[model samples]
Target: MGLFIFNSSIGRKLIMSISGLALILFLLFHSIMNIFVIFSPEIYDAICKFLGANWYALIATMGLAFLFVVHIVYAFWLSLQNYIARGKERYAVKKNAPGVDWASQNMLVLGAIVLGFIALHLFNFWYKMQLQELLAKLNGEVLHVEGAALVQELFASPVYCLLYIVWLVALWFHLTHGFWSALHSLGGSNTVWLPRIKVISNIFSTVIVLLFMAIPVYYLIINLLG
Candidate 1:
């Protein structure tokens, strides 16, 4: 069974589906927590402090990282496998099939864009906060980790704020397509459920991205007004 899962396309697709959904859930949780930065930064900082350099939080972060790596690997593996299975037909220029959206067709491109932004985000935020704290703890050094202050300082720059908007847009496109695709692979492929799940995907992606986008937008407003 383990070998089948490692070697079979279906099993790889199943792993992708489950891991993608798990990441979506994590995004939802993180997005809601992030919104506190806009309204009540104290709450946001408190939350960050609670999660910083703690054993439980570190464990959860590692687990999340593992899921992300597995999902990414399977995604590339499946894409390559599909390309190989298509043989020479992959080069044929054909019109879009009915019901296949643009995002579905260009998922690899969108995934690449999203992946790039994720690295930027981790560098700007995670490296400054959780990673710094982890390092300080390891060396018995002292450091302040105020995530809210860090967010505001970074987003205060019009350039960074604009970059965040671009990132969120890419993320929205990726999620809207990936959410439905993941569900379809899991069991929503039937005629009755696919369209319904697609609608949910749009809503879910919009809400999560909008929540994350709000912080940057709010900071942009402040910068403009001041």
Candidate 2:
């Protein structure tokens, strides 16, 4: 069973679907946590401090990273397989399949864009806060950076704010396609559920994206007005 799961095409898609769904849940939680920063810095900082390099937080972070890596690797592998299976005919017949939307067809490109931004996001925020906290522990020195302040500091800059907006937009496109596709991969492939899943994916992804994008736009407007 284990061997088949690792070696079979359906098994690979199943793994991707599970990992993708897990990451989407993480994103939803993260988006809500960031929203708290807009309301009360104290609350957000407390949450961040609690999560800062603690044993449980570290474990969770490691798990999240594993899911991300698995999702990406499987996605690349599956897309490559599909491309090769189609050969040159892929570009010929269904560059834009009749029912496939742009986002669906361009999912690999969207995923790449989102993956790049995820790195930038980790550097800008994670390196400053949790990584510092972890490093400080190694040196036997106390150090904690309030994540709320980090959000404000980065979003205060128009350029950074705009860059985040771009990332969020890319994320929206990625999630819209990925969410439904994940559902289908996970056994929602019946004709009855197909259209319904797409609608659910679009609505849910939009809500998540808006929640995340709101922070930067809020800060950008505040900075401009100030």
Candidate 3:
């Protein structure tokens, strides 16, 4: 039964939907945590400490990594299957498809952009913070650093701030389409709910992206003024 589901087209889509939804939930939690940095760096650092390099946090991170890999691999598999099924007429059909948002039609491309930025983000923050702490623990050395200070330092650079803004824009576009599409794939949307879901997706994506974008913008302005 499990193998059958893994081999079916619908089952693949279900995997995508489930994995996408899980990532969305993580983004919501992360955005909320990032918002705290704007108002109280101390509070944000405290929250970071709470989540840092602990057993539970490590487990959660591993789970999150698994979900990302599943979603990405399935996405590429589906895209290839679609291309093969469409054959030489794929572009012709896509060009004629009306009422489809640009983001919806180019989810794979958007996803690639998002994935690239995610690597950059991991290097900028995760590698420097959580991974560093984990390494220190393994080495039997104590290493403590304030999460907010690292954030401020990175965002102080204009180039990094600009790159982050670009990344957030790509993320906004990706989420706007992915959010509704995932729900639709899960049978939660129809003709009646389609427009409603689209609206809700837009609003939700905008809010989440804005919350995240605010951190870099805030620190950029502070660096400029200070």
Candidate 4:
């Protein structure tokens, strides 16, 4: 039964839906956490320290990695399948068939952009901070990095700040479609609720992305002024 469900298209979509929802939830939590930096750097750093290199945090990070892998792999798999199924004719159909949202049609491209930026973000923050601490622990040294300092340093550069904003734009586009689509896939949407879901999705996506974007923007202003 497990193999059967995983092997089928509907089941694959179900997996995508579930994984996407899980990621959205994580993003919500992460956004709220990030918002702390704008108002209280000390509190933000404290929270970061609390989540750093501990066993529970490490386990949670691993689980988050698993969810990301599952989501990305399934997304590409489904996209390839759809492309092949649609064949060359899919491109010929230039006009959108009425109700299709722009984001719905370009989800794959947006997702790819989001994935690429995620790598950049992880390298900038995670590699320098959490992973550094983990390595130090293994080497028998205690290292505590200031997360707020890292944020300020990274956002001080105009290029990095611009790239981050671009990344957030892509993320916004991806979530605008993904939020409602995931619910639709899980049987929480219908014609009657579709409009409402889309509105909610947009609001949710915008709020989350803005909360995240605030940190970088705040630091950029601070650095420029000083």
The TM-score measured for candidate 4 stands at: 0.95
The lDDT of each candidate is: 0.89, 0.90, 0.91, 0.90
Evaluate model 1: give its lDDT: 0.89
Error of 1 at 91 (Å): 4.7
Q: Is candidate 2 or candidate 3 better by TM-score?
A: 2
Give one digit per residue, the lDDT tens place, for model 4 in 14-58. 999899999999999999998887789899999999999899999
lDDT of 1 by residue, 1-226 (tens): 7886678777787898899999999999999999999889899989998899999999999999999899888879888988888787565677877877788888788888888888998999899989999999999986669888899889879999999899889889989999988998887677887789999999999999999998899999989999
TM-score of each model, in listed order: 0.94, 0.95, 0.94, 0.95
Task: List the candidate 4 regions with Cα displacement exceeding 4 Å.
Answer: 88-93
Model 2 agreement with the true structure over 1-226: per-residue lDDT tens digits: 7875578987888898899999999999999998999999999999998999799999999999999999898889889888888777434443555776788888889999999999999999999988999999999988878888888888889999999999999889989999998889778778888889999999999999999999999999999999
RMSD of each: 1.5, 1.6, 1.7, 1.5
Show the colliding residue pairs in model 4. none
lDDT (Cα, 0-100) at 59 in candidate 4: 98
The per-residue C-alpha lDDT of model 4 at residue 35 equals 88
| Candidate scoring better on TM-score of 3 and 4 | 4
Worst 10 residues of 3 by lDDT: 89-98
Off by over 4 Å in 2: 88-95
